[model samples]
Target: GKAVFDATRPDEVRQFFDGLEPFDHLVLAASGGKGLGPFATLDLADIGSGVDEKIRPQLSCLQAALPTLNRSGSVTFISAVSAQLAAPGVAGIGAINGMLLTVAPILAVELKPLRVNVVAPGVIDTPWWDF
Candidate 1:
């Protein structure tokens, strides 16, 4: 079932998935954050926003779907290649994406049998860059 819901709102995410039948895989592609700029001048709040906007929503959606998620299935997280690149002015975003990368391997072990993977794509000319 495809429906529009706010992933950031835990309750909404829970409610939406609660109405769905058991599924095979979950792909977390939600994106939001203001983590662009030099580390020294970056707004600390942007880092927090990265956690709030990216990390929290993905984790919350996964948590809410646990009951319906098949153990044999997989969860794929969408992150940015900035996490692995050594480019300047990406520390904030990189750190944020890196956090997900760090947790994925551990979760792969903990989740057991269930596959947990992250895909870090480089810059894409999407409307998101229009800002």
Candidate 2:
């Protein structure tokens, strides 16, 4: 069964896990279609936010799922290649991706036996790239 809850809302995120049975794995991928373009020309407000859309929500999910995510259950975060390559217009995406890469290891240490890992895929032929 799939339930729809706003990932941005801490309360909703918590309620979600509270409803789920003990699970095997938790995969956190790029959820929202954020990461607006051309860093220089884009709005600062757009890049500055998306805590629910980009980073903080992961923490919220982890915190909420701590109890339900069983021992040996893994948490995988799918980031972009921007973190490594640092291409021309990927400033915002790169920064956030880098942060995620940095935190995955720390989470692994903190949540021992939970098997945390990060997957950063290279440039995808997605609509986002149609700039």
Candidate 3:
């Protein structure tokens, strides 16, 4: 059976995490980050779309679960190199990446003693394309 995952639906998203145990680390990566890198750069619009619908929920859920995480655990978000590179149709991605970059620092500062880092990957071939 094929199950459709909708990030926009909070309940469905939450259900996905229902019985999952707390993790020492959380990684946020998307297929779009890899495919779009070579052709177009990231931009504000990309960021907005990337973060709002995709990244935010994961981040929010993790944050909500922080109390259960190891105090010294790390949280890592995979950003894109496009944050540094500029190209067409990338404004949204770039902005999102930039936000991720900023998020790490903010979390590190606010969650002092907790390590937070954003890995801005260049490109990677993943199963995301199959979707």
Q: Can you list the residue pairs that collide in candidate 2?
A: none
Per-residue lDDT of candidate 3, residues 4-75 (tens digit): 555456676566556456657656553243224323443335445666665676576555557655657877
| Residue-wise C-alpha lDDT for candidate 2, range 34-118, written one tens digit per residue | 5646787865565556445767777788889999899778998877787787568777667767778899999899899899988
Best by TM-score: 1
Question: Candidate 3: what lDDT?
Answer: 0.62
Order of candidate numbers by lDDT, starting with the best: 1, 2, 3
Q: Estimate each model's TM-score.
A: 0.95, 0.85, 0.68
lDDT of 1 by residue, 4-31 (tens): 9888898899898898788889999887
Better of 1 and 2 by TM-score: 1
Worst 10 residues of 3 by lDDT: 30-39
User: Please, what is the whole-model Cα lDDT of each candidate in the order they appear?
Assistant: 0.89, 0.77, 0.62
Over 4 Å off in model 2, which ranges? 125-131
The parts of candidate 1 lying over 4 Å away from their true place are none
Clashes of each: 0, 0, 16
Candidate 2 residue 128 Cα shift, in angstroms, is 6.1
